[model samples]
Target: MHEMSVALSVVDHVEQAVRPDGAHGVRRVHVEIGELAGVVPDALAFCFELACSGTVLEGAELVTRFLPGRASCAPCGRTWDTGMPPDMTCAACRGGATELLSGRELRITEVHWSAEPAAPDPGPAPHPEESR
Candidate 1:
């Protein structure tokens, strides 16, 4: 499935973004998917687990936000939700003219890194400290 490739690409990007900043692992990743993007969320989730088997994001949670398909109805003078198959006509007015506004998005928004506990600072030694 194409989901496998998509998941692999996402993992690759997350690793690249985190590895350079002393980050060893990723905790969560936020991905935005649209109804018209033609991506199956279930398939993508399955693929993500398989693709991340040996990657740094192996245990990272794949958080997805689904956006509704929306189109602008010129006759209605407003933007409204259009059912899948992208109904070309406005539901309210039943007009043939309409403008597609969104519902074709597929993007990786951000990645959250696992928080690392701060290292404890050593206290002052018994000997006098040098007054540099």
Candidate 2:
């Protein structure tokens, strides 16, 4: 499925972003998926798991935020939720002229890195006089 490819691409992005900074791996990732993005969340999740096998992103939590599709009619200067429809007319003025404002977004919003505990720093050895 295409979702598998998409998942792999996402993992590539996350790994590239975190690996340069010494991150051991990713703990979580947040992505925004719009109603019109044409991505199936369940399929994506399933593919993600497979794609992440043996990778730094393995077991990383995938948080998805669903955004509603929105469009605005230029003639009436009106905006409304477009739901899942491919095309819509202005509800206020019955105008067919419209431009999409939001939706069709499939992007990563944030990434959380696995927290590795820092090594403890030993203070300087006691002075010779104090030791005596």
Candidate 3:
């Protein structure tokens, strides 16, 4: 399924974002999924775990935030939860919708990572004469 590909892409994005900070591992990856985004959360979560195997994100948690579909009516400037169309009319005035304000998002919102281990400090080298 496409969820596997999406999961892989998420890993790529997470790596790109955390690599500069020398992050050793990912703790969690948060994402917002809209009702109209056409993605199955369960499948995506399952695929994410598979995609992250052997990577920095291995065993990382996937936090999903589900958003309800919403549409705004142009005639009356009203908004309501339409739940992904086929019934997107404004509840306030029963008018047609002009724009969709939200519920189409499918992107990573945050990435929590573990700090990389600090480099060990080396003591002063022994003197050349002491190297006998």
Candidate 4:
């Protein structure tokens, strides 16, 4: 499925972004996907796991947020939600000409890194006089 390719791309991108900063691994990845993007969230998640094998993103959580499909009618200047199998025709004016405002998008919005914890701060060295 195309989801596999998409997942691989996500892993590559996450690695590219975090590796430069010395990040040890990725904990989570937040992605925005439109309803009309033609991607199945479950499939993407499964593919993500496969793609991440042997990579820093292995076992990383994939969080997906769905965006509604919206369209604007050119004739009536009206906007409405065009659910799956989007109806491009304007509902208000029954106009055939319309422009898609949103949806059909797949993108990575955020990445949480699994970084190493900082070492505890050591107290100042003991004074020589105190040691004596």
Candidate 5:
């Protein structure tokens, strides 16, 4: 699945950024996906989890934000938000010769992590009669 590939890339990038201390782990990954990027969020999340399993990024969350598309019409010389429309027509003059503004990005924006030590477990509680 393409999600698997995307996840791999994400992990690679995060690894480069995180420096991985003894107790540190990737906590979250923020991603920005364009509406026209054709990536299924759920599928990507599923693949990401599978890819990160047993790795330093294990249990980390994947946060995604969708960016809408934009367009500029050549005929009317107007710019507008295409909203990733099916035909990508210019809303201003209904022109087809419009330049796409965005909606073709799949990038990791930021990464969050935690390096806290694991808490120690307390001894079991004493039974009613065991404690004097």
Candidate 6:
């Protein structure tokens, strides 16, 4: 499924974004997916887990928010929800000319980095020059 590719891309983006910060791992990733984006949420979630295997994003939580499709009519200057299988035509004036305002986006909004693991404590420094 294309969702796998989408998931892989998400992992790549998250990795790239966090790499500069020297993050140990990812805690959570928040993304916005539009209804018209054509991405299956459940499939993407499953694919995301697979895509994160052995990566910095492994074990990270994937949080997705879906945005409803919206369109604006040029003739009527009215905005309305297109819903799934979006109807591009305007409801008010039945205008054929319309502009999509939102709901085609597939992007990462935030990435939370996991806390760095604590270093093990060494007991103490050994005495110097104990042996001659």
Return the lDDT, model 5, position 22: 60
As for TM-score, the candidate ahead, 1 or 4, is 4
Q: How well is each residue in 35-113 modelled by candidate 2, as lDDT tens digits?
A: 8988899999888878877777777878899998999999879899998776588878999989988889999999888
Candidate 6 local Cα displacement, residue 42, angstroms: 0.9
Q: After superposition, how far is residue 64 of candidate 6 from its true place, in Å?
A: 0.2
Writing each residue's lDDT as its tens digit, candidate 5 over 46-75 gives: 999888876778888999998877778889
lDDT of each: 0.80, 0.82, 0.83, 0.88, 0.80, 0.86
lDDT at residue 122 of model 1 (Cα atoms): 61
Flag regions of model 6 displaced more than 4 Å: 18-22, 117-132
| lDDT, residue 78, model 5 | 86
Looking at model 3, report the run of 10 residues with the lowest lDDT sum. Answer: 114-123
Selected candidate, larger TM-score, 5 vs 6? 6
Evaluate model 6: give its TM-score: 0.83
List model 3 lDDT by residue over 29-79, tens digit each.
999999888889999999998898878888789999999888788989877
* Ten residues in sequence with the least summed lDDT for candidate 4: 114-123
* Residue 20, model 3, lDDT: 42
Per-candidate TM-scores read: 0.77, 0.81, 0.79, 0.82, 0.76, 0.83
Candidate achieving the largest lDDT:
4
- Weakest 10 consecutive residues of candidate 1 by summed lDDT: 114-123
Enumerate clash totals for all models, in the order shown: 0, 0, 0, 0, 0, 0
Residue 100's lDDT within candidate 4 is: 94
For candidate 1, list the clashing residue pairs, or say none: none
User: In model 1, what lDDT does residue 75 have?
Assistant: 75
Q: Score residue 45 of candidate 4 by CA lDDT.
A: 97
Ranked candidates (TM-score, high to low): 6, 4, 2, 3, 1, 5
- Would you give me the overall lDDT of model 4? 0.88
lDDT of 5 at 81: 66
Writing each residue's lDDT as its tens digit, candidate 6 over 85-123 gives 889998788889999999999999988886663233465
What tens digits encode model 1's per-residue C-alpha lDDT throughout 90-129? Answer: 7778887888788988899988776552233366766656
